[model samples]
Target: MGKLSFNRLKRYVNPEVFDFDTTEEIPPLEGIIGQDRAKKAMEFGIKIKQKGYNIFITGITGTGKTSFASSYIKKIARTEERPNDWVYVYNFEKPAQPIAIELPAGMGKQFKKDMEDFVEQLQRDIPKAFESDSYDMQKSEIIKKYQEKKSELMEELNTLAKSFGFVLKDTRTGIISIPVIEGRQISQEEFQQLDEETRKEIEKRAAEFEVKALQIWKEIQSIDKQARDEIKNLDNNIGLFAVGHLIEDLKGRYKVNESVLKYLESVKKDILENIGKRVNKLEEKVLEYFKRDIYLVDVEGERVGVVNGLAVINLGDYEFGKPSRITVTTYPGEEGVVNIERESKMSGRIHDKGVMILTGYLGSKFAKDFPLTLSARVVFEQSYEGVEGDSASSTELYALLSSLAEVSIKQGIAVTGSVNQFGEVQPVGGVTHKIEGFYKVCKEKGLTGEQGVIIPHQNVNNLVLTEEVIEAVKGGLFHIYSVKTIEEGIEILTGKSFEEIYDKVYRKLKYYYGLLSNKKEDKGDK
Candidate 1:
């Protein structure tokens, strides 16, 4: 537990050194840096192509899950058959149930355009087809044929009525029969002068003529119906002829895209059925909604009790990681480490536990010799939502230790790792992203060779970083340290050994213990 070797007390990251101003082009990232097992998992997920065996990537934030998945899937897609594209079309059978059609990649956009152009073209062709001289002449001929039959029916009825000594009359009140004598309508006086027998005969004969007139009207109604059916067929045939060429062209173009061919056929019917309706522009709106801005990294600065910790926020399908600034404040009291996050309900169970673990570590190390009485608060700055994870526990302890020892940690570097009461650093998730987030900030602010990150030694195998970060490290403009214990982190951040720091911290605690004791006794309090 004592007299540790200088080499054992520190494990330098030792990034590759190079001329700061070299113009050599750093190669593009061909693969993830240190995650071989994850790479294999990715391959297995992509190759199987089976149902219900979807891939679920599990790792701490900043471990490069999104980056790895996106790049790998994109690379795989280039060689594999592309996924089908989907489009929403208006359903005619069930208007509320919009139909979803799937087309091949790169064809959805074209199909959508073709539909729009079809809509515009329909507006021009439909009126011309309806207004053409041929269409009008054909329609007029049907009406004239029906009218000739109606005239012949009237003439037959009039001849039959004459034989019955009655007139077959057409009037606004409808068809009627009137008494006739010698090819002329009879006056009321003349009708009364006729004998009762003659009058009854004339009335019976007029009733027979009425029956014949009704049969003619029935035949006329049938002819009108036949003419309407013919006109409707003519209209539909003309419309289909105008649209068939446009649709068949698309069907031939996307013959390999089965879904697109079906969609085009549906579109053809829809364009004719709804000549007055507009085409949908849904893809444009979706693209506009998904357009977003990505923040690359965190800013660098030096302050006591403040350290940069990595965190991730998933915006549904899209995800990103940034650095969280953790800060701690301490004062004299009988209280222990006060977790502001826990008290305000801004932290999760694991995070609350991580802070408590630091208290245990502090008591076991220094309070064993004296009363560890102090009031301190630890908080994650600018954290608006509940934070979960012990990954930043080690960083929080570092910040607390800096505040207690009055040591200033470098702002250019960030850290991620969990710690225990034994002061051993444990592995954390998203080690790669945490390093890269801080690196971007440092790079933006100008990475002084000193800017880098400290991570747990066990987490080294989990790293998969971007090419820019790799090149920066190689050029000596950045670094990444892997520490196994808190002492190494302390030495790296403060440039002082744990023994040197503990010596000063122990003396300070003892002096405070005695001072508090004297005050308690003077006031006759426990």
Candidate 2:
């Protein structure tokens, strides 16, 4: 318990068993490095293709997450075909709603042009067809025949009107028969001069002619309608002749694309009907925000009151663990363990509880012999978002103890785990992520073979890491130590036996107690 064995401190992966000089000699492992569980999970996620089954690649920053994800996704994308482009065109049936069409890439713009050209060509050619000599001659011949038949019918009607003592007259209303006397149309006064019997006879004859006149008018209307129908049919044929080729050409070009072909068919029908409508056509910045130059990596120097405490930084979608410098200062007061984070309202309830636990631990361990008269202030230096969880309880205690003992801790190693009143190191969450986080930082700062993380011994089972981290461990470039107690961690950090640090802290506290007792005695005498 006093001094930990080297094997117990670190579970080293001996490179000799691999029978290879370097990791390059070994085939690259599929998926993430040593994480067999995570690899299987990732494979399952890839095959499922369902919503809410996304794979979350979590670890420390600079752990090759971005690089690996990018390369892997790009490789898969290359094997698949490029997606077809979508185009939206105006809907003729429902003007407010537009229709969407899928076309081969780069074909949408051409389709828009073709539609515009079809409208423009129809506008130009339809007018020309109607004005052409051939079209005019055919239309004129049909009208001439209708006019001749109408003239013959009107002559028959006029002769019948004369036999009935009436004359056929063209007026604004229509062809009408007027009563005539002596060879001229009769005035209203002359008609009145006629006898009642004569008037009755005249009215009877005029009624008979009126029926015949109605028949002639019906015949003339039929002839006129027939002529108009012939002209309309000629016009439609000319229009189809003018633009049918243009539509057929578009259909042939996009025949292979079903969506495009359907869209073109609609266009053909619409153009023939409406004639003319309208249509129309990272990571570095992330590092800059969350990463501070001072907080990026661990330094390789010993300092009292300052310990590298591990923590997880959560950026919503991305969460990574990193080391924060936990610092402590002691003064002559009975304020107990003063958590500066709690004082500044930046510490969570759990973290405050952990700090209170520190007081309990110190009171039991060191204050049993003398009154605990020393005031210690513990702080998570340079932290802004506030501290949470008891994960760093062990770290804070290490910093507080180091301040009391005036012992310098190894700055290269970062510690994570919560310590109870009995000083037993308890497990914390995200142990795998925390270890990889420090490993990445150490790798960036240059691994000195001594740079490592101290995790709770219980969390050793959660060590699913990357291949690169495993390779580094195999080569002794980095390490991960699992400890069962604060005593074991203090020995690793200060490179001295825990008994030595305990003696130093005890002596300091005893001296402070003597000073406090003498001050109280002097005040009583006064």
Instruction: Tell me the tens digit of each residue's lDDT in model 2 across 28-92.
Output: 43456556676566656667756786778897676556666776677776877776778887776
* Backbone clashes under 3 angstroms, per model: 3, 1
List pairs with backbone clashes in candidate 1.
62-430, 63-430, 301-411
Candidate lDDT (C-alpha), each: 0.71, 0.75
- What are the per-residue Cα lDDT tens digits for candidate 1 across 1-526? 7888788877775555654444455644544557788889788878996788888877777767788788888888889877877888777668899878777677778878987887788778766665566865775565555545554555566667777777543321345566977655665689889999989888787777678667766876676677656655665676777788878877887788766676677777765665322111122222222222132223455677677777643221233446667888766677789888789866655578789988888898999867797778898876655666678889899888887877777777788888878888877666665676567556545667888889899778878889989998999989899999998998887878888888866776677678788888989964
lDDT of candidate 1 at residue 400, scale 0 to 100: 84
Clashing pairs in model 2, backbone N/Cα/C closer than 3 A: 33-467
